[model samples]
Target: MPIPSRPRAAALAVSAALLSTSLAACGGDSKDDVDLPSQTLSWKDCPAPSESEGGGEPPSPLPGGTEWQCATMKAPLDWDDPKGDTIDIALIRAEASGAEDKRIGSLIFNFGGPGGSGVTTLPAFGTDYAKLRTRYDLVSFDPRGVGRSAGVECEDAEQLDKYFQQDSTPDDEAERQKLVDNVSAFNGNCEKHSGKVLPHVRTTDAARDMDLMRQVLGDDKLHYFGISYGTELGGVYAHLFPKKVGRAVFDGVVDPTEDPEQGSLGQAKGFQLALDNYAKDCTSQVEDCPVGDTPQDVKDKIAKLLRDLDEKPIPGIFPRDLTQTAATNGIAQSLYSKDFWEYLTEGLQQAYDGDGKVLMMLSDSMNGRNEDGQYSNIQAANVAINCADDKPRYTPQDVEEKLPEFRAASPLFGDYLAWGMLGCTDWAVGGAADHPDVSATGSAPILVVGNTGDPATPYEGARKMAQALGSGVGVELTYKGQGHGAYDSGNKCVSEAVNRYLLEGTVPKEGTVCS
Candidate 1:
């Protein structure tokens, strides 16, 4: 929805809180009535993440010397034609450490992005979920159209570098046209490179793949841990296979009720809220808030800086300058977690002095471009999946009509987010729906966790998700903390609540609040 910023591309890394899990190593078939090929999984020692998965070293072994294993499951390329050509759904797992007799089945995770490589992410954050691993094999996977899973490829790094540099919030007709042309060109690149895969990368297709994955993994029911966009995916899965949902947890829940336009607008307000909170938190500290004299002063200064960057770019990351768009993205990336607030502060201070390296790095991280200038397929897949799932293709007039409302939501972020509507304007594939359908009348209870200070997937989304998931299917948990997802917050109540539900099948009381 929101052209893949925190609205969310789940703004990857999920900030330090989500990724702060113990670093380690990190599938599916068609929708309904999948007749998966009967085959035993041949798991092997995991290899280093592929270039599309954000090139990195192989995951280190877990704390107790349990190594991560990787496998690939074949799923139908198109669920509508279940017996059609297959696509490999990359999977990774760490077997349960507890006694075999006591071990539950697999506990799968999807960390949003619609694009993030679970093949890489699960290992990096393995230890954080060790408790869950005590009884269940911790599992995650690269959904179809993601890394190592027939990944979608678009523009190369050099093209993307220039793509990100262009002004996103167009001010005039010519600038608007240029922005549209750039978006069209980028979308064109995706179609030219991965057209065959684009049409089948919808969330429904991935949901179907998960059902097939359940069969291949020998899990009677899908025990999922979904975060950010992962939450949306989980909801869609529940909708498709209600009885198959078992002990699921959705944190950083996406609002399934809103269309792309509404969702993007919601993000503008959410990011603004996070920014305001950051300002207040900083200025109230014992030492001076280096960025400003007061909370409002802090915001004013940031607004001014963005305006300044728009007029004149600052030196950043050697040859790459930090433009207004880059700084905004960087700031948005930092606000994904309270731990990253320090980086935001430092980035702002550095930018103030004409040193834009830090901000550019943050922006680079958001765009899935590493220091080596190699770009991951996350951006490409993000657009592919989102354009395939979302039904609306907003025009400039639609954005212009909504400009006042978006501006009223957040002065610092409104225009940038509003302009993002054009991202899928020229997408080759037709979208599935205006918004996802998450209604699951006979589904198992899904614990939906929402953070009060979430900058993406705002707090209201949790209530909406719960209500939409239908009575008895979605239980709401409120965490009075700052970050993208609640489980990773290390909040005693949130962790206990989630753990108890997933492990013991003990549902927390509805509307339960945790700090």
Candidate 2:
């Protein structure tokens, strides 16, 4: 169970809770002279993150002593009514380190979550993108309904702890009814606490915000880098602002053609594929595999563990136990990066012996729980944006009807993912469309990077995103690797090609392959 969050997020991005905002709602006619495209951002040293942004210390400076600066950009709360209410979109930046003449303006990043705090994430992974920063001021922000940007609140942290512990995959009609009740309560809490902003957190709204950001930053073209769900955002931006596009790369691309149900089904298959790969890698190791002697044995043991947990939970983090849902979530989180496979093996081995702490910790990470036992708004905003973007509202019957297909796609993750399709059930806001429109016929060559082993967003999506972007506008670059994203895998072939494209403006040949 996971999300479009670049990786390490729980299934179908479910769960959201209670928090409130003081974002002012204004009318179109106002005396305010400084609007978003015209407002001057006052950059200053970034303070430690707020609780909603996954509380952490301020970012350290780059290797060359370049400090990470923070700023707030104003955008209309509702894009349709341009002069209406506004929200503060938190931003972070590391000024280009190269000479002024060599600079290529800013590279705005959106690292998927639809809910991730870019203000925080960019710094956490600052060094990873430092090479690109040499010639471009690397910038990222908290999108509307996300952390520190008028974030959407639902249940309180305590309530969410209970929410995550409850059975998400219902086995009987009574359990199904209870599951629905829980979801409705969660959605109801969201409306009760943050109704004003729920209606406006669509992906299209974020895309327009990005355009305003590009203009305010004095960039004629929007040089961008998008990962996971960020890729979907980039596609929508390209579709809307074709001429303004420049040096864009989409990694772990989403299939822009699928509706909600189709997308979920694809993710089911993707996660299963990742599980299969993980199994093969583990058992094929030179040293004896810790979990199992064969790939099928590895998967079989995992399935049995889940079934057993469903019957009797095991001791996890003090006061909590690793239930079936948590175990499923933890396993999915580990699959996000191959580096985490060892942790999965360790957790699984420990679980076999009745210790569930490692697995629960992994699940906590997926749900954005810090070591202090507090939760972030990642799951909340993820639901807010995804719900507002996807038009389909599924009922239990719809899921029950589709369970067989999902299970066939992924025996381990099938039911977990199938049940996730109901995340938007009775949501307060009406979604914008069945799927995003990513047809940018006249845009520049936008590189679309697809990893063959990406779990959250499957490998097939790269080609779909490219094909949807229209002929020459989309340049497809394939990375034959594992993990949620290509460039982040530290593969030299993939990194060199992306560097040449983004830094030197040399798009790799349309079908270039990297391993």
Clashes per candidate, residues 3 or more apart or on different chains: 7, 9
Instruction: Give one digit per residue, the lDDT tens place, for model 1 in 1-515.
Output: 24353323235343332223111111222144644455566899998888898887888899879999998887789876767898988999999998999887999989887688888888877888989998999999999999999999998888999998899998899999999899999999989999999999999888887877776777778999998899999999999888888899999889999998888888899899999999999999999999999999999999999999999999998788999999998888888888789989988999999999878888887888876788888888988999999999889999999999999999998998999888898899999999999998889999999998988889999999999999999999999988778887779999999999888999999999987
Query: What TM-score does candidate 2 get on C-alpha atoms?
Result: 0.94
Number of clashes found in candidate 1: 7
Candidate 2 — what's its lDDT? 0.85
Error of 1 at 211 (Å): 0.6
Residues 1-515, candidate 2, lDDT per residue (tens digit)?
A: 23455532222121111100122222112122234335777899999988888876788887878899999988889876777888989988999988999999999999887788888888777788878988999999998998899999998889998888878889999989988888888988999999999999998788888877887677878999998899999999888888889899999889999998998899889989999999999999999999989999999999999999999999998899999999999888888888788889989999999999888887887887877788789889888999899888999999999999999999999999899888887789988899999998779999999999988889999999999999999899999988888888889988888889999999898899998
Q: Which candidate is the best by TM-score?
A: 1
Model 1 spans > 4 angstroms off? 1-31
